[model samples]
Target: MDLLKTPAFAAHVESLLKEHHTPGVSIAIVHDDTFSSAAFGKSVISSDAGSEERDCTPDTLFDIASCSKSLTAAAVALLVEDDVNFPNVKWDSKMSDLLPEDFVLEKDEYTRDVTIEDILSHRSGLPSHDSVYMGTKAKRPDTAKSITRKLRHLPLAKPIRSSHMYCNLMFTVATHLIETLTDKTFSEFLQERIFAPLNLTSTFLQPSSVPPADRDSRLACGYSYRESTSTYHAIPVFDTPEDQGAGSIITSVNDYIVYVHALMTHAPPFTQAIQKALVTPRFALPEYNDDRERLQSSTLIGLGWEIFYYRGHRVVQHDGSISGLTSTHFFLPARNFAAVILCNGDAGYPAVAALVRELIDQTLGVEPSQRLDWPEIFTRGRGVRGEAESEDADGEQKNEEEKAPSSIDTAGAKDMAELTLADQPEKERGSEEKYIPPPFPTSDLPLDRFTGEYHHAGYDSFVVGVRASPEGGEALFIDAADRCMGFGIALEFVCRAEAGGDASSPSPSEVKFLAYLTDVDECETEILEAVFVVDGDDRTDAGGKIGKARRLGINLDEDIEGLIWFERV
Candidate 1:
């Protein structure tokens, strides 16, 4: 079949392999129900000439972490269709009702109240308290039970349906619910209903269950960065049967394409209901970057899929990341085009998404006016090369600096001039006083008193430390997992307290902390803020509960929050 190849495909394949420093990649393009798939580079790098790089093939199996969410969602759709009793199912179904009485969450109120829809939409009010899984010696069931038990004590960050917080626990709950509803495990339910019907024989819930030789033949080994060594190394894939609904699916690019096609076309029993669920925008994700254009429009998130605007068209997609593997599947329903890229390295998905958009546009002859020139945009525009010029320089150096900063400065100055003109003299500028700063209130507790280790049952371990600033007032720091995760200037804290406080009896010692970090190229800054509350309660014989504190909110300036919790040692 002589289907037109994208002009950028070869170049993109080569560039992605180089830019991400990946050893190998397997890519698939499905257009108009026809399929084309290929693998590039090598699966493994070798030190000796006798060893050859393993070639990625169409059948290369990847650990498609969250991509399995879509499959799980589809399976639920099938079950809903099979039995009218399904949608009537409530969020509060008991695991004991499905399995044994000792099953987890036997006593939690919230756990009893959570439903199937809530689980699918990730609105079960479950925070991503992942430490139980990461640090537990308990096998899958025990780990899952511990997580459910922990949820009984964990406070909800937001009201149910108030917002979307991507969490794995909700899906786990959904898996249990499905088992209860169908009297079958989630994997069995999926196999009997969705996978088997679609003829996706190569896809399955467990990786280890496959034959060792077959696993060696198709499995893509995962990888992660060694911060100390400044190199990449293999990372073990999480082995758990219970996580099948959450993150335990393994499939080849060809098999995943079948799933993506089913999604785009609404094939089989899923045709009506699945289509409705996939396009609905559950919540608005925070602005991805300062590129105001992308941030302004709300992207719709379906049960497990994210719908993005590309070339004025809605595209449904999702990316999966597990240890060393990253996979992206995006489909343009309007254009009848879809792309899947799977790699055995920690490659970023944004690039693959962009490339897929480009391929779809080229194939369909739909020109995208606002397409970002990526690596270049990251390099020259963001000053990622570290070749940015200083303010003071000689003639030759001045010219070099002027080449980049001059353009940015000109644009910024123009925007500032427009703002200034709009605010000018017809309004009596001198009469308008500058915004006055608020004064900090006197407090008896020394800064050191508030400086101590604090722990949240669900969130993570954090330390409140203070250092004397040259400006006189102390700089407060909140360290989580040895990383200086947050800080706040004294003035900012005082202002927040004054603006939003109990006027009669606000605690002067408690203040909010906001931390801002500049990107690697210093072209952008990201902020994460949290309210810091001091506890007056005394330590107990049991692990002392300092005063009650909650993460009131979080506004991450970046897409990747890295807001991980520490496990209890």
Candidate 2:
């Protein structure tokens, strides 16, 4: 029986496309060590003004996104096999040792002590500071260098290896280290070492590097559905992130089959023993996903894969999502079975839905009585469009504080707000000019040890500590480029009699800062300031593993609520 041409599967696929307005998709399945793939719909819609209606082929290119992590993990494993004489490539070696001599996170000792395994397993205690990797200003191989110096300023989301937060920044760090050790960009190394060996020619690390003819014709364009108009609009593809190691892989199912065979058999030209070791579960993840209210089928993260038991069978998998594409790759080594789905649409939809349906069909003995309504459960992969707040970001609550439109759209302005422990306070949507700053223009207290680099997930690092208040006062002499201050508000503004922002008030440990909706790169015309507060003993704290820094109390900013403890660098 041809399952690919089965009336039930075709009906299901057609129904899903109509329901979500998705344009194209590619599906690949491997069973009994054999592979088959099919692509449906045009790479671009027939109505797209500048694009042609080319049917997606089995070899059509689609951004694999975070699935790149698994491939990268394979690369690391391959290198580990050959690392006998490579002095800087040890899996257990501290990143500080592999990085450039001047690279240092003076305040955080844990940052320097991180191992390669820490990154692959998502235990580096770093959250995604993707703002630095997005948009036109992306930092690539240099991102490793940038983070090393700035990491001291970024607060750890959790203690070293104490928790898993799924960080792309750490993977970028790994890629950079790999580059430094091999003296080549990660893309160059993979091509020579992995892709060439497997003869997978349709895969590329960058869209620009795709064959020029295919780049313009066969590359799938991403789209987002707008509820307001009930239509899909094309979203721009981001081509230059240092995160190529973390999320930027683009390939077709035919080429990916070669990758799958490599995973299953440790395909010749690669070290068999090393590939065998890559799937070993290395880190424990939360056994129960609160949202699912059940133990995760895949509860342990492996070198670049997730290992879990499903229906009494072992499975290894990893999923990827970007603006326009959602993908899933899962394989059961014990059963010699695997399947991959690449959906050219918004986050969740078709890809996950397809994966779930395929898995059930391939694994269980029972046949579905009816086609499953996967969109009903998986919805959009990344987010549900037009919802007040999305509860689908794994478990994070997203509150988007809309910004004035820029010439270019940045990642959702409030996208990562929930990724951190920041507090979300609802405000009426309106212009920033109409809102008031709550009269927090001056401070009477000594700044004390408030001078240092303060880091936040979405906005990158802001300057604080020492003399860098945003309001005109003692920090008035500091250049705008150098001043990052906390604006205390209401009673949080009250300072202790000694520190002196104002006569002793109730929250002695708390301090606030001026936060505004602007870029925070420079002070702009009468722009409203959002208040941020910090709590502390007003003394320099030291003698920790990472290094010398002032340990301040939890700080709260107007747009966000979290205990921000700043480290002086």
Candidate 3:
């Protein structure tokens, strides 16, 4: 079969590299189970001293970040086929039951209730609250244990199956659970169950596990942009055995294609059941409006993937990012087309999505649809419809005025009083008008009330800690292993009033949490309305009942809105 190449594929890749100032990129396209790839720029940027340009190749390895979740999900499916009791198994299953007693749940309650489905669907309610990995102490295994122990004290943001909230803790917990069940670590289970069977040799969870001979030759160095110097710099790569199932997998475009093929073809019982489960929109994210024409009105979140409906086609895809690198892989099963793009630098996901859409259109022989240009459209509309205009007429041969006089100001007037007296507001006769600020009650409930540890029922290891700011206020902090990554590392909250302007009415509150990258880039933010609902004890707390925190919206940002939920806990 002739694989149709996009007319702008090469030029688009070049333009993205230049525009984003990316150091290196690796891309692949899959059609009819066959694949083709291209690479550009240098995997490692040059420093003050001269260095060889490290060109990206099709075989270049990239840290796939959260793309690892799909692989983990696939492994779970294999276990399900092995007659592992998926539904009946409690999340808090003793590590000693499956592994060693030393591997225990920190929060007895969390470990007790969490389940395999909870981890896979990201409904574990655990907040992505670890910042220790960014620090020097990230190498310790106790780091993972510390995070796990805190889960018992933390409160759930939502009840089980209430909504989706992406939790790294859940994935790690699932990894441990898999080891307990199969007598293997997460990497070992994946290698035995999924990778080896699919023949995906280049794919693995730990980067160090890959042969050293292939490191410099096939591995792409991760990079981050230095806005100060206007250049890219290499960022250090570190691994956490705990976060392995969540975001630690590293692989190449060619190997990821094999995984995507497995997803498309449904290699077995996993092929049919998991694919069906993944494409079903499990939750509704906030409506996202973006500059791209292809993304408007079409983005939704599946189990571990993103569901996009562009021009009447269903596209399932996901994007991954760590500190220095960003990666994206998307496929349209209906059109039998797939594209994987991995960048060594923080080039972002929008470009990758646009490229995939373009490729799909080219391969399917469909004309690309024009995006609505808001600025141009508004400009032209104003010209044709005309802005509010004024007319001046004399007795004979009165000509229309094209422009209004600048000296004649209309500030503070309710209507065009100069044009018509009836349309204007009545002026007070000899009385001065005073402007009064609206009265509203601000909550005096100390920020400390909001400052506490939060636990997710679905994830035993994840904990969110809100601390009093040294500046004399409260700031949110995330505790993953035993360390704290400062506020805005994983999630942030914005307080909004209940009724438009009634802040003093003691009105019910609403908070929106903005999830950001370690470098402080916004990923996917979620908004939860504070509603009074019955809790298990039939009492309302500051956080609200976990059951009511449903996913009311999604994907407002370029990143996929993972699991999002809200509970007082």
Candidate 4:
């Protein structure tokens, strides 16, 4: 007998989504060789009373986030299989040999010695170089190369292969390798190699690449929440074609399971040779990065998977989150079971993992979880995830903090630049004053001089451009593009300020600025701040460019003491 009746399971899923304020969810399961799928809730919902919203269906598209790495790893394995006669690509192949000849990691020799195996398991010693690929204005076509060129200057977070730090850029480099070795764009190669062979027409890297007509009907809307009102607002899908290998692939749970089944059965593209590499453990971490409560001493990471013990049972899986979406792909391969859970909301982050585990445990007749408690944990004032992560390790309490359908609720809910700006408020006939330019910019330093490309010894480059002040006159109109992780920053003002240090030696800095969500045009502002110090003559050029005009040191988080410094090219 099924542990959960179909109707009961659907009801439970809907309950979870509403309780946690996640609008939509999709789950697919392969139990003892039979395939099944369930979806519930609205793909799009509004805090606004009169707004149009939409429902999610079995075919709804989702931004699978880091789960894309599994597909990317599979692509690499196929290349290895295909290269039997040519320059053979092996797991132990040193990355120095694979990198484009022109690229150099000048100071980090340990990095050059990193093997293909290292990258697959997130052991490249590179921490997430978020500022590199996230906010930069660099053309998407040049992102991989620019990141490669800038990589030499970044210092490793840990000794190479010594520990796991969840570096996405390493995968970016791997995708670059795939492109170079195959002489094809990553997209083209993936289409010809993985998607076609698996007959997965719905899976793709970019949302824009999908037909507008089809996307309108199926793509699930992502969302974010504000604590004050406890309301959920829709977020747009990501615009991340630049970091394709790292985190941009989008697909539906239904389509994703087809790929999952192929891997399970060792189907075609995932041959026995590739399966060996795919399942073999590469790097091990102490505990699950996201879930601290579930302690797995032997958490070994595979080429594109995470192998850990759940209830003393071996389970292989991986989880991904960016902006509005969170997803997990997990299963007990030895038991011939697998499941995928995708939620389209930032608020859904913590619950996805738990739901996957509980469902599997109940199906397999294993010890059931005592309490999923997503609402008790993530609901506003109940101790949001951010608060939990920051809580004292000794134990304490705190709390705080999307998508589609099945028998669950289906909600109802567009483009690039217009969507990002949010509100799209038309100019009322009487408001000409809104267009007036401000006089005199903010900041004690010469603001015009900061515009240029800047490089950090251990991260990607940032381009500084000038814009008009949004709030008022006398504030500098400045926009600094972070090329590392595509984080959003809306230029507001530049000013002289100091934090820490006594009156005798106040640190010079720029005022706190707003970072926007890349996916949503009218994103809810989190009020995150960054403090940057500009330096000039004292900096040297490791970057191949000359006459660059800026030196910036930015502090992203308030609690951590680490500061990232960048020199103008």
Listed per candidate, the RMSD to the true structure in angstroms reads: 14.7, 10.5, 17.2, 9.1
Q: What does candidate 1's lDDT look like per residue over 12-39, in tens digits?
A: 6767677765667777878889998887
Ranking by TM-score: 4, 2, 1, 3
Q: Once superposed on the true structure, which residue ranges of model 3 sit more than 4 Å away at CA?
A: 1-8, 49-52, 84-114, 132-149, 293-298, 369-569
TM-score of each: 0.63, 0.69, 0.62, 0.75
- The residue-level lDDT of candidate 3 at 78 comes to 65
lDDT of 4 by residue, 1-569 (tens): 55333787778778878766788888887877787777788776644434456776667889888888888899888877876533658888877777746346544576568888887777766665555564323434345655666677665555677766566777778888888777888889889988999899898878887888867777887776644445555556745655778777878888898888788778887887787788787765443233434434456778878777776777877778766677888777777888878888767765675586677567657544553443343443323332112321211222212111132211111122223333334221112212111212444434454566766654545555555543344333223232323333433343444344422332332434322223222233332333444333322134411222345555442222355666768
- Which window of 10 residues has the lowest lDDT sum in candidate 1? 386-395
Task: Evaluate model 4: give its TM-score.
Answer: 0.75
Q: Against the true structure, whose TM-score is highest? A: 4
- Model 3 residue 509 lDDT score: 45
Give per-residue CA lDDT, model 2, range 90-127, as digits (tens): 57777777674633443456757777787787777665
Task: Name the candidate, 2 or 4, with the larger TM-score value.
Answer: 4
Show where candidate 4 strays beyond 4 Å: 1-5, 46-52, 83-87, 100-103, 134-141, 287-298, 367-550, 556-562
Model 4 RMSD, rounded to 1 decimal = 9.1
Task: Quote model 3's TM-score.
Answer: 0.62
Candidate 2 has its poorest 10 consecutive residues by lDDT at 476-485
Which tens-of-lDDT digit does each residue in 1-569 have in candidate 3? 33323555566577767766577788888787777887777776655434445778778888888777777766666665554565434323333344334333444554555555665665555444443232224323433344444455444555555655566665565566666666777778888777888788898787787788776567776665544445555553545465666678888888888788778877643567678767676554444232443343544556567676776778787777765677877788887777788887654444454456666666767654554333333323221211001101100111222121233222212121112222222221111321111111222323333334333332322333444432344444433323222112323343432433233333344434433222221111122122221223222244542222212221112112343232445
